[model samples]
Target: MTASMTSPDTARIAAITLTFLLAGTVKGVTGMGLPTVAMGVLGTLMLPAEAAALLILPSLVTNVWQLLAGPRLGALVRRFWLMMTGIVIGTVAAASFIAGSGGVWATTGLGAALTLYAASGLLSWHFTVPPRHERRLSPVIGVVTGLVTGATGVFVVPAVPYLQALDLKKEDLVQALGLSFTVSTVALAIGLARASAFTTTDLTSSLLAVVPALLGMWAGQRIRGHISPATFRRWFFFCMLALGLQLLLRHLI
Candidate 1:
């Protein structure tokens, strides 16, 4: 390995730290944005697979914490089993091609996904999934979400929207996001490993990233009561929209 690979320069390290710090804050305030924000920022600096590799440990640890902190693990597992299964299948199926494609199209796809996510949030689009139709749609949404995760290293979009449409109580919805994100993180790790994108160095980097993430989360939590989440969310989505457009243009041009 080259010096650059073995010992990341101070500038790169600083960038990564700042990226995770901001991402963690987003998660802390919104309750679900670490991976999304991190991926978006890091994707600008590295290949999609490399960004995904850096994401594994931090995303997994935080999401697992989110999962365990919630009230209903078993119940949520039972309720979303099929969707989770589909996520695994879809992620595994797409991983090799997406993660190993040198990130040409992967970057484009990530840009597109971010754009869609930002657009949906900014528009405040809401769709209700009746209990009766949820069973049929859940697995499909899970699979699509997984595919998107595989390609972009970001796991939002259809999944979050689907969960929100379920009419779940507030706490349950948070827990559900935790569960789904945990599963997505695990599947993504496995996929990246299989693609040879996640190595020991990547693992170490990811583990270290957890610190800034948690610290940012703490800071965000401290200020959560001061700023309205809705106002923050609106601004956040707008920023994301601009970032997404930039990514798309960068890759496309």
Candidate 2:
């Protein structure tokens, strides 16, 4: 149902609008962080699965814009072919599992893992598999990430560290993330399709929320430059930590 059709609770409406605004703003500034940020915040207000479903279309659309804009697209594809291959395999495998037997335990486990990852970043601990070994290891990362995405709709964390180690330019990093998400989104769509997760109602809700999400991105872009890089990084990690804890608690209790 449309927001208006739902019982008019002014407070609830304002909260959802604000959430969408923030989600859009983050997307505009970072190009790929909206779903991560939005899901974290929205999870507090809605079911985590529902929040993730809501983000799928907008994330796909936003990332498509980035993937088309990046330079060296061909080079990126060539270099990461194995990673992509692994992601496809892993995503498909994990999607099957999710389709068959999804539950609170799986989601809670994902939340805990995400929290640990964020905490590691906060503590400045890094995991490296060495450059010479990257080819072999990269695919493993892809598989893990894909599985996480299949199960929880938040697989970006797995790729983040490896991407950071590449020392790419800021724009390239953003583009790479967008590309990564593009792959995951495709995989997710397939899974959702098989599970019959996308109903007329789901699509209707997703389409209606797109405007708010886009608006939030625009606002976030305007403010991005004003914030320091370090501050942004810290805030991102903090949000991750908070999101993880909340998810854990939700499943536990």
Which candidate leads the pack in TM-score?
Answer: 1
Cα error of candidate 1 at position 145, Å: 0.6
lDDT of 2 at 162: 78
Query: How much does candidate 2 score in TM-score?
Result: 0.86
RMSD of each: 2.3, 3.0
Quote the RMSD, in angstroms, for model 2.
3.0
- Number of clashing residue pairs in every model? 0, 4
Q: Which pairs clash in model 1? A: none
- On the 0 to 100 scale, the lDDT of residue 24 in model 2 is 78
Instruction: Report the lDDT tens digits of candidate 2 across residue range 1-253.
Output: 7868676656655666677777777677656566667666766676545666676777777778778788867877777777777777777677644443676655575577568767877887666556688788779888988887777667576887777777678777777777787887777767666676655676666666677887877777787889875677678778889888978788678
Against the reference, the lDDT scores of all candidates come to 0.88, 0.72
> What TM-scores do the predictions have?
0.95, 0.86
